[model samples]
Target: MLGRPVSLIEADDASNVDTAIKAATKLVKDDRVDFLMGTFNGDVAIAVSEFAKQENRLFMVTGAHIMDLTGSRCNSHTFVFMPNARMMAQAVVPHIVKAYGNKWFMITADTVDGKAALQAMTEALKAQGGDVVGSVTTAFGATDFTAPLMEAKNAKPGAVILNLYGWDLVHALKAYTKLELAKEKIGVGGMIGGEQIGRPLGYANNAGVWGLIWDPKINTEGSKRFIQGVIDKYNHTPTSRCYHGYAAMMQVLEAVRRAGTTDTAAVIKALEGHEFDGLKEGRSYFRAWDHQHVQDVLVGEAYGKELGLGHYKILATVPGDAVAGGVEQNQCRL
Candidate 1:
């Protein structure tokens, strides 16, 4: 993680926890590597967190939205780069309730990611002036959602916030369409709409649906530059996930640079209450109580039709708040 460029290793499978454990064991024992990155999956992130603790190595988790990473299982060696379930919940729930209140159902993945997302969203809704009709959680890699779709159709939520990623979200939408759930419900929630769900599914489907996306189209000069860089490098604009990785990489590298050493202790010290400049949405910091980064969340409705680079039609910004809700924040002395 220091003195040289960070190296990445895949977790082997998105569905299998054992594969991630094996990879982690190898990385810590055989490869003799320092801090690890990449959250191929939420379960993988959890597995890798424990591995990092046992091996006494630093771990920077990417693409995981589970609250438990920093929650009950939080360890000093683990540094979460991706937004936690609570942060994501904080980001979307307020806006969703304000815009479309009283009816919400969770199309959750049976996996850790889906369950956690559903829990977070439910809590957020209750926190706001909203009610959760009910939610249905399905197992990971479920192909047929007919049963759940039937339940959803009966429940008839105003919004179905799908807490899934990768090909899973795509499949869920397809199932929703096949079952005509999209036709019945207002749209999905807790996700930034119109970016991914729009392209493969078509703009027509995304219409009226909203997702909790971080609008990269902000007026900030730095945001423009960051978006341009992604487009220039990848030939396609960045989405929320891309932005998360980019910002996290930059933040981690900066923390290491500021600490002037890869020593975990020093880096941790420098990172606590640290502010990041020259980045889009300027002047964000990592809280000392919880490691969540202080930044803004984007709220947008689907509209654009372009592939990869299309922008959200209308966007509202929500300022970042504390991500200290995980078990680490509880201070339980067991």
Candidate 2:
């Protein structure tokens, strides 16, 4: 690694598409950064990618999982390092069906990404001979989920799949507890839930089958070392977003190193269809067809509280190639 200092430009005003584009444009016009990254918002991510292509700068999607990010909306300047909604549904639905039952009730976040995930999950269920018993859509930042939780409780489906993330997920879990849904022995699953919401509640409350994009405790030498290094540096455990950021940075660095220059085109060439080690998933690579990172999707169980932060007992390791859809499924032209 070079000793040269890497400058960081923070964009606190990235709440909307217009603001996100403006912040990125300012960085390229003023600081002249080699590339750009981030934006957890799906619409904002698409706007930023358009900026990247127009500016001839590479952009790595470190967060956000709108299927279109790597599907119809993908571009030459954008590469997605995180799994998308479709991948999440395919990886977790089978496990949910086997563990719980065929009937499901979905309480989904009201957003484009949320809608896409719901559709993908619905298709997965149909393919597996499972069925959706009932469903409800809620606003993105709604604080109270009592009404929906009560409705879902009465429906009495075999399980409830939360198509929620971030604060929405936390709110729904607390409401689920307060409403005494757990007393009925009904199970809860999530298409996009992780340690950010689970750790605070501990295993006893968060216990169940769930999908995870990454885990710091995966059994591998590289995984253990990477997890330890983060703890040593940050004095805390890593979240799924932390793992996503790390993997994206690592890929960028590797591309630059292999390309032997910071030129965007060369770096992009170096990354696509290239396999590499160091990820917790024994191996990983960016698909040339769509720029989606192909790696294992983990299904884990939290049976007890002592598993600790960033820890979960693996229920299954869904193969990356098997889960990452093929070219027929890929819509990206680039």
Candidate 3:
């Protein structure tokens, strides 16, 4: 997109904040990378954002949804590509309220990301006159969900919101199905859910309506092409992580083109408030106040193959502005 030779450098933070900071700082100090991207979860992302601020280098966040990234922890050098926790809650909770009732049970991973997402969802649900009936916190990698599911079953929430991800989400959903929570009229949802969960479990097993950043089948020319391209290259549907990488690359390349240089200040200036097409969403921009990208989100319901729907079907298209809340909603002062 920049129409020029671009260099790439990569590192593994091993999911540790201190390791991430050390590794990122080395890249910036050695002048080996023009910009940095990533840290899978929120705690490491916050540390990496601090590193970008101290070093005065660009850090484009790829996958980390903690509200603080673009909220209180936001910095001029850090721009976020993916939606934050609040955005995820806004994208899915209202629908959950309308369809599944206001009473909810929360199963959260005990991490900053998990807690932040749960808080966001709680606030959104409360705004709709909904409330949490029960809650459970789990260690991030724990596979057994029997205890939590049993607690949720006893609580008899109208819905179960899993503020869990990766293998945690996978295991919980499988257990939820095994226990037949749906038979008790207990619906399932999550702050974040994706093909990662749906693809493996199949729609019948994966019962819920949830928020998603992007879906290959979303009705957009750019999204269709992006999905097809990934299929051709990877021989599988792209994950939300892949979408984040593609979106971040597009934004950074566009910023470089507009700035005409790799200077951090110039690129940052170019990106702030700049709007463009090509995102899976119709159009998106970097909000100048918080450096969070504003874009639409998908609300999808898991549907079985028997229903003639692929893994999940889009239920609503929540506009970015509708879900973005406002500057007042953000804790970022700059």
lDDT of each: 0.66, 0.81, 0.85
Give the per-residue lDDT of model 2 (tens digit) for 1-334: 3445666677754448888887998889988999897878788888899889999999998778888988899999999887787787888888888888879999999887678778988988898998888999999998999999888988998788888887788888878877778688678886766777776666456755777888766777777777788899998788888888777888888898898888999999999999876366646888888888888888887554546555567778787888888999778898
TM-score of 3: 0.94
Candidate 1 structure, TM-score to reference: 0.84
**Total clashes, candidate 3?**
0
Tens digits of lDDT, candidate 3, 1-334: 3566887788899778988988997898885678898777899998898888888789999888888988888898999988888888988998888778999999999999899988999999998988899998999898999899999999989999999888889899999999989999999997778777777776568888889887766757777777789889998877777888887888898889899988899999999999877455556888999999888888888776633324668888787888888987678987
Best by lDDT: 3
Candidate 1 clashes between residue pairs 3 or more apart in a chain or in different chains: 71-327, 110-138, 161-189, 191-211, 191-212, 192-211, 192-212, 192-213, 193-211
Those runs of model 3 whose alpha carbons end farther than 4 Å from true positions after fitting are 1-4, 306-310
Overlapping backbone residue pairs in candidate 1 total 9
TM-score of each: 0.84, 0.95, 0.94
RMSD of each: 3.4, 1.7, 1.9
Regarding TM-score, does 1 or 3 come out ahead?
A: 3
**Mind giving the per-residue lDDT tens digits that candidate 1 earns over 1-334?**
3577766555454556788788778877888765677765778887887787777776777667676666666667666665567666776676677656657877777787777877877887778777777677777777676777677678877776777665666666767667776556455656434465556665555544344435556657777888899888998766666766777777767878888887777777777777775254544666565555556555666653643346465545655554334444454221
Model 2 clash pairs are: none
